[model samples]
Target: MLPFRFIHAADLHLDSPFAGMSGLTDRVRKHLQQSTFIALDRMVQLAVREKVDFVVISGDVYDSSNTSLRAQLRFMEALEMLDREHIPVFIIHGNHDPLDSPRLAVTLPPLVHVFGPVPESVTVVRRRDGQEVSVITGMSYLTSKVKENISLRYNKKAGASELFHIGLLHANVDGNQEHETYAPCSKKDLNTAGYHYWALGHIHSRRTLQESPYIVYPGNIQGRNIRETGPKGCYLVDVDETGAVAMDFRELDTVRWFDMEVSIGDCRHPEDLRLNVERLLTDISESYTTGFSMVRIRITGRGSIHRELEDGFILEDLLIDLRRKVDNQAGTVGFAGCVWVESFCLSSGAEIQLETLLQEDSFIGELLRLAETELAGDIGSDSVIGHALRPLMDQPEIRLLLTGSTREEQREWLRRAMELTALLLLDDQEAGGASA
Candidate 1:
């Protein structure tokens, strides 16, 4: 039996910038760029700590189609650490890093083996106590887009003398909606391949399809954005001679991604909003091991403060204050900053006197009718009256003015419409107040 273990990891989108993201501090940007190397370093450390026999990187080692020489060198240097520890490394070219690229010219460590695009496997012979163990495998990408099922290519069984059979593939594996449908295949396709373990990649989230044959995705070593939030890392697998497998998830990410939603429904003033934000940050910072963290806070829900929060600079200031609080509480947790506020709704209980306005056969009634009709068609449409009148109506401040008991309730609907209008016009300010 081969008395050794292996680490499987993939999708290291190194040095990829969050281009469309806004409201980020300069420190956050720098940390993101440096996180790639940090993750790589952690992987190497894990391999050395466990004294694993080999490490397999499924694909997407670099973020660019044309990788820089500097990045290539740094990557090789990190791998050299593993080579120095007398451990071998196996690499497969993913969709991002397809074979036949001449940009990578750095001399790799002798212990490292990089598989080409063709589906071929090299046997690794390990000797322990005068006994030899042979591991057979096949891997490759063939083309940028391997539309036809590639799992069928590995149907042939391994030799009887082979101690372990493994297949390293960069495939979509039965059409995952969350990922690009690259090399698609069914579970039956993999089961019939006769491989004891299939190290799969392409998807950014870690998943274990089956434990019997051990089909797994180590996920991306690090999360790149808000969409890819949660604990991101690699997998450590220990397979015995009898084909019994044991797997454990090991976190290797230096930077973490978190998405937080703070509802301002009860926030009547800017200070209330600030207090809510501070409380949320405090909770998040306490939950994480790393004092330094990056957060994307989404201000949501209907509230009176929605109009004040629409101001770009004012919202930015709120984020700054939240960051300051987190920094003060836990000096190590770095706030990457906040995300764009999706929408702030004003649910104040106040109604527009449409009956009074229409009693005089005024334009306000006609405008209200048009808005109601458009809203009926599609309440989300930009042409809704609330959206149309935002620019003309000006009420920057929020006030508690009520007359009729039910009048307040009626005005709330008008406020909501005004809120929607403000969003449509991109006013980033409050609309006119409703009169009971």
Candidate 2:
């Protein structure tokens, strides 16, 4: 067998709009909107530059079944570029972009092969070339919800011993709770399967579960939100003549997302907090000098600013100020590039003793006590607090982000929220001003 190289990527979710953020400059928004396409373009450029034999995208090319024309056209153009370079592309649709879903009328290049609903194998072949045959076998989603274990259906197709076999699938392995249980299977199932490599998708976090047979998920090409933060990209897999595989992760995101918590435990005033935020923004900007940053600034730990932030409008005002005084300046990312504060949260606690407050006999005390009992009951979703979170949990994508949260975590948050609510309701203007 001859040594060959290829790029592996998945979970494009192209044209997916970024949301739940504010104070975004016009230029930042524009950069965010084009980030997905830029990521794909980078992948194609990498494929051509590395001279890879083939490219494999495990699944979820579009964010929805009703794929946008812009996403389709951009994806098509990337394929055309690879076609010109004579690099083959193999893709399979996941739960988000199933085989039964309707898409715009756009045709891809001949070098692109989109796998069908059932498990099937396709060979990597180019005319006037002499190399051992390698096959890519994959299956796509028939519908958005696939619960049955379909990994059992795949096997190394009856072919010559010299052929290299690669398995591709967009499924949940071993019931990973962070994502919906779709096309669930165990690692053992994949281990027993007679394939040289398993390309997996459906989980948005890149993971390489096995190295001997090379089971991998390249994650989404772009991080769409704070929950999907940090560097996002694909894997450039190089295989030796002996079929030994080595993978190198290449970052391709044009806009990075960040959620940073700045603790004011030792701070006394708002000015101190401002200095901390400036330092954070500087670090974020320096870390990703080549692109833009969408940051969610969370102010945590006990501080005198807690009482001031209880006004609700104070947080809003701080958010506006952060945007104006934030990186790049005047609604533009300058030549040096910068970060934008997408959202602001004041999760800081009051300097007053929590135990003293909880022991009180007032409405605030009762509220805090109930937060640990009735509010945290099993009928949480039916309660007021749960009702408020219903909207976020209703959306599949947002729910997926919350899927990892446990009841204890929710209860702890409920207590903190109740504490903040109690502070907001009280008109204590001087209780914590000693530190302010």
Candidate 3:
């Protein structure tokens, strides 16, 4: 039997809105819309090129229940491309797009097979060489949340003749702090399931659980925002006749994610920051295919140039100019355009002073202690306060005051505002003395 090779991917989040974005140019926003679809098309193309035995999409085919009809149709069309190549596609719906009412009604490609909500079994796919290959057994989430552990549903053992046994699941194994604990299970739970490979989903970052059984999360095909940065893509698994699995990560995202931290510690002027940004972008452009890549530049560090970086309009203009240059030079070769700057924040070295306050006996220090006590007592309420005061705390003028203000003024207005704001918002009066 020919050994089985398959492509595993999840969390497509198709047509999801870029909710936390601002300052994106019209062109960039347009490109973001096509990103998921582009990545899906790329996945199908990769599958066709590789001539894999089958493709398994663990879960999350769409972004939400309110996904657009256009997105649904486009997705099916991409699947049809795989169908044309005679490649069978297996999919399971996750919490985001459960197999129920309200989702876009559409027909899947003939070659596509979707697992139902309940756990079920599928026979091992064999090769023409007469060897029994892998058996893929899986289940989808019926509702938005499956509170109970679902690993028990996949407890069946694989047949002896099968070279590999795979379990496809949409779950948050253990308790991932960054994600909801849906379908929680332990590594031991999956190991006991007796599967050679466990393809998992829900968490957006790529991860490898246990190599012996090969449990993994391939991450999302395309990143939707700054939080989901880095190279987003799928995993290619090559299984040998002895059930030895070799895996490699393949970049399927047409739009690459970049979260670059540009330090301005030595920058003497705003132009210096501008030039530094240009240098960084130029360096990135050199290494990547321009139009197809996206970059989020964050300006960091304490420097004299921090004050000048305060003008959002001017900084944005500089970024736009840089993007224009990059786009003009390399837009056609599938480079979408120039870099898209997400956000810029400035900090003054006030944190050191704040740290000292935590151990002091001064009035400000005592107030800071009290705030911390309150914060510990009820974190959720204090979080709301922090969110409300974040604008004032983040203001460039306020950050500059921490250093530039005279001793008398610092002891009066500056220190008082800091302490009061920290107590009321951050639940830590010590933050007023914190370095920006």
**Highest-scoring model, lDDT:** 2
Tens digits of per-residue lDDT, candidate 3, 227-280, equal: 687778899889886878888898888676688878877778778888887787
Q: List the residue pairs that clash in candidate 2.
A: none
Taking all chains together, each candidate's TM-score versus the true structure is: 0.75, 0.84, 0.79
Query: Model 2: how large is the Cα RMSD against the reference?
Result: 5.4
Candidate 3: list runs displaced more than 4 Å. Answer: 103-107, 127-131, 157-161, 310-317, 323-337, 348-436
Q: What would the per-residue lDDT of candidate 2 be over residues 34-143, giving only the tens digit for each residue?
A: 88998999988888888788999999999988888898888888889999988889999999999888776667788889988889988775323746557899988989
Question: Against the correct fold, how does model 1 do in TM-score?
Answer: 0.75
| lDDT score of residue 402 within candidate 1 | 21
Q: After superposition, how far is residue 290 of candidate 2 from its true place, in Å?
A: 0.9
Better of 2 and 3 by TM-score: 2
Per-residue error for 327 in candidate 1, Å, reads 8.0
lDDT (C-alpha) at residue 308 in model 1 = 68
lDDT per residue (tens digit) for residues 1-436 in model 1: 6655788888877666656765545555666677777888889999989877778888878775677666677788888999998778888877776675456556789988888656766666442232344354556564466677777877444464456777888888878988888878988899987777888889998899997677898899888776687788899888776767888999877667677777877877878977876677567656655524566776767666666665556667766665555444433534333222212232332223444543545445555556555535532326554364455345434222222224335445554664454344333322332221
lDDT measured at residue 397 in model 3 versus the true structure, 0 to 100: 88
Per-model CA lDDT versus the true structure? 0.68, 0.81, 0.75
Locate the minimum summed-lDDT window of 10 residues in model 1. Answer: 342-351
Where in model 1 is the C-alpha error above 4 Å? 1-3, 126-136, 311-313, 323-436
